[model samples]
Target: MKNLIFSLPFFLTLFFGTHVNAQKISDGQTIEINGMSVTFNILNKESVEAGGKPYDRYKVSATVKNASDKGYNIRLSSYPQIVSNIGLVELNCINATGAKLTSKKIELKMKAQMINVSYSAYDKSGKFTTNMIPITGSYYFDPGDTISDNAIFIVPQGEKPDVSVRNLR
Candidate 1:
């Protein structure tokens, strides 16, 4: 019983360690998740003044491609994270003049056909129009579709941070 108890913990750790390890991804590398290929890269980094304080600004780009035959709806805005020696920094956008910048989250919808009909008996001028309103917080990907967008993240000055994208499966 004593030998079994000692070996059981070791065996359990060995069994679970492989599954718990996260795959380390380098910069500008692409990973496929659920038939969607995601690529994240830090384009540019510089020092900028935001809210009267110096901060590090990063221009990051993310691209997603749908390689599957089916469509998928996924959110890409919340996937990027910045980590430094001080730990995870809050991601936000700020301009050079210390003004907070608001970036629109990229949301894509699968292309679909829509039919609009107008039936007017007394009106001589009958027109059909389609209006599209942008929706926030989600995006849809169709087969063979690709999209790329750039965002800015500001962090404290003098901090060297690394960008990582959370797995989107």
Candidate 2:
């Protein structure tokens, strides 16, 4: 009973704290990412569908749109990023063969790459719920492309998002 009492407060704080600090992200919020006009939308979901299949998961999806006239490359890990109020904790999923990050390459070609992403969803703790994920990932984005990919940790926790996707100059 004593242990429960002690842990109850901790659990409550973590639960309620998530709500208290979640910054409202408007739909189609345009921001400058990698020297491009990037529009993003965040979605809370119990599970995400990918590759014509579905699985159980708990995470947020940041539907990103590269509204630029150029292409950009982004790196994705084998797992999701743990984002708190402080910021996104490093969740680099790079390793060797047979690893989820083995093919960590994402290529974006304007509207061509805007097709629905076929990657599996995972927990924020870097656990994969499905096997349909990119290996050796390196994302390339072109101008005027809207891609709804759930491969990031957009949780504000209790602070503003401090993750910057700077363009390669």
Candidate 3:
């Protein structure tokens, strides 16, 4: 009886702990973390030419709102990633084989006069870039304020992968 009682608590903890730590979010789903409400979704997919090369681009969007009464600074630890049958593919510049493609990571120089900055991939110059949530620095959010941003993921030709947002909090 004593063993059963002790094992019951352990089993319960194992079950609930895994549930809380599963950070994978799907399209149009919202999750609340640290008094902030965040929603992630894939908006659309299209073909585009970047730097004279043709590739498939997926547009993923994220919406974040300050639910707390007090203002605070927030930033994403990592951007959303493309998951395929092989594995999780990250944003990179090098192209690899085996049903997976590489993505480009943009490095930007922060201007001294800029405050409350956001990112986007749409440039008039036709260069490939991702307009992602600011992972470089924290942005201040007032109470009840919301911010929406889009990220463009470039994949190899004819490859469509599922998107997943993890460790967003």
lDDT of 3 by residue, 1-169 (tens): 9999989999999877645544545567887766766676668988777667677776666676768797644443444432222111122223212222433321111111123445657588988676534333334556787666555667676865344332222
- Residue 75's lDDT in candidate 1: 46
Ranked by lDDT, top first: 1, 3, 2
TM-score of each: 0.47, 0.28, 0.41
**Top TM-score model:** 1
Worst 10 residues of 2 by lDDT: 87-96
lDDT score of model 1? 0.52
Report the C-alpha lDDT of model 2 over 1-169, residue by residue, as the tens digit. 9999999989999877644433333344655545445334434434334444443222323334555566554554543543122111111112211122222211222221122346567778989865443333444555665554444332212322332232223
lDDT values for all models: 0.52, 0.38, 0.52
lDDT of 1 by residue, 1-169 (tens): 9999999989999866633433333448787766767676768888888668887876767676777898755443432323122111112222222236723222222332233434434334565544544334444556888777677656678753344333333
Q: Which stretches of candidate 3 lie over 4 Å from their true place?
A: 1-22, 47-55, 73-139, 156-169
The model with the greater lDDT, 2 or 3, is 3
- At residue 97, candidate 1 shows an lDDT of 24
